[model samples]
Each structure stands twice: as structure tokens, then as C-alpha cells.
Target: MREVGDSAASGAGAGDMSAEVMVAGGVPLRRNGDGSWSEPPYPAVCANGHELGPYRVTIGVSHCRCGILHRTAQCNQCGATYYLPRPTDRCESTALDGRHG
Candidate 1:
């Protein structure tokens, strides 16, 4: 329900962006027949021809025990991706023990 440009500092004073994620009919997006929720308005294209849209929040990075991190988006070409909930002040992510381009 929140615009991609909407933010906590937009002067609307609606609180942080994290507090405003909702689904269909304000019912909250749920799992589809394929067991995946309809894309949250983010842009995504999978190798398998899966196209998603408008993700509210992007998974910046995910920390791993191997001293690596992962990103939410994966390259359709190489079939590579990462996880989520990375630490603060860090945007660099690790995937499959290598760098992603």
C-alpha cells in the first residue's frame, strides 16, 4: 500500500516504512496456488521466466557461518542468489562463496 518513494522522512509522518506492508484487500498478501505470495510490486525476473514486482523491502544481505553473505535477488543467467537480514552499515553480500555481478 505504500509507494516505492514513500519513506519515514517524506513528511507524511506515517511512521517507518517497515510498519506499512499489506496484502490484497488489506488482507495481506498470501501464498498463491504455487505456494508463493504474489510479488509485492517489486521487479524480479527468474531464469524460469518468473516475473515479480514492487518488493517493499529488498533483502540487502544475509550472513553465513562461512563468513559470507547473500542477497535477495539472484541472477537468472547463473542461477545464483543469497539470503537476508544482513548487519547494519553493510550492503556487500556473499553468495556461493563468490561475488555476484
Candidate 2:
């Protein structure tokens, strides 16, 4: 049996990586015979209750001009965009410093 993190056996190298990998929380996703990735373990539904599937979602890496690597997902149904791991740090100042003058 192939061990976890074995990129060679899992076909999860640079070229073979899929968005399902991130959705699965780093677990290598299975590839179907037709070159499509299998569904992830947990459901990834948007706020609008749109389930993200192979056909209903588009996932990819976005190179922001700020030099940050952003793994993004877009719901094909409603055209909603998402930044994987969600940009929670944007409001860190408000969350961290809870004092107002």
C-alpha cells in the first residue's frame, strides 16, 4: 500500500496536483480514468448552499500582485469567488486590538 505523503505513488506532484487536495486538507485526491479528480471527503458548499463539485466549481491558484499565493475557488452556479482558507487576517487589527477611544 502507498504511504501518505508519497507523492510518487499518489501522483500528487507539481503537475498532478488538484484542487481537491486542498479541499481534502492535504490528502491526495484520487484521479478518475477520464482524468478527473474524485470528490473530496467533506462537502464544500458555499454560503448560498451551492455544493462545489468537479463540474460546479473551478479551483486554481491565484498569484496576487502582492506576492501572496492564493488558492481560490469559484462557484460556477452563482459566480461567487472564494479564497481558500479564507482571508481572515484582513481584519486582524479589529479582532486583536479590542479597544476604542
Candidate 3:
């Protein structure tokens, strides 16, 4: 598997990241013979043609406002983001600081 970039600074920094981080093509994607996306989370390519890496978002955080649990793929090349749904058991949601309600 090809590692994108320095994940620490590629897409996540401080509180900017909201999606869970996964490995590249870690979403059980199989390349179809037609060269199309067999599984959505398979080939995470950005609109700019940049390959997206695995990233996770928050799920059941203490005070998460997103409501659902999922992760996001961020392009290590162009810095773009894509949202993908994931099971809550897969990961935990990121808690928001100073959250109320």
C-alpha cells in the first residue's frame, strides 16, 4: 500500500479533522474489471485527481453534533475531503470541547 503523506499534517491538525482515519484502500474495495468504483470506499480519488487516504471521523463522542458516526478521506495531494459512513464499532467519535446540549 502506498502511504499518502505525513498524516499528522497532511489533513489533520489540531481540531480541523472530523473523520476517522483508515488505511489507503482499507475499505474493502475491489477494482472492477470495468475500472469503476466497485466499493465506494475503495478508490478515494479527489476531483482534482489526487488520491485520498484513509481517515476517520467522530462517531459517538460525548458531545458530538454530527449526529452519525463516520470517517472522512482527505487528499494528501490537494487537501480535499470526502465523507464516508462507518460503523460505530469501527471507531469512536471525536469529542468536541466546550460542547453543550
Indicate which candidate wins on lDDT: 2
Pick the winner on lDDT between candidates 1 and 3: 3
lDDT of 3 by residue, 1-101 (tens): 12333242233322324322333423423234343323343344676786555452222213224454345555666655555544345344455553453
Best by TM-score: 2
Tens digit per residue, CA lDDT, model 1, 1-101:
54333332222212334334333322233234343444332236654655533442234445444453433665445544423323345444445555642
Q: Best to worst by TM-score, what's the order?
A: 2, 3, 1
Residue-wise C-alpha lDDT for candidate 2, range 15-89, written one tens digit per residue? 555412323432335655455665333348866889998899888655443333456678889977776434444
Model 3 weakest 10-residue run by lDDT: 56-65
Q: How many residue pairs clash in each candidate?
A: 11, 0, 14
Model 3 quality (TM-score): 0.33
Model 2 weakest lDDT span, ten residues long: 92-101
Off by over 4 Å in 2: 1-43, 88-101
Cα-based TM-score, every candidate: 0.24, 0.41, 0.33
Compared with the true structure, all predictions reach lDDT values of: 0.40, 0.51, 0.41
Model 3, backbone clash pairs (residues 3+ apart or across chains), number: 14
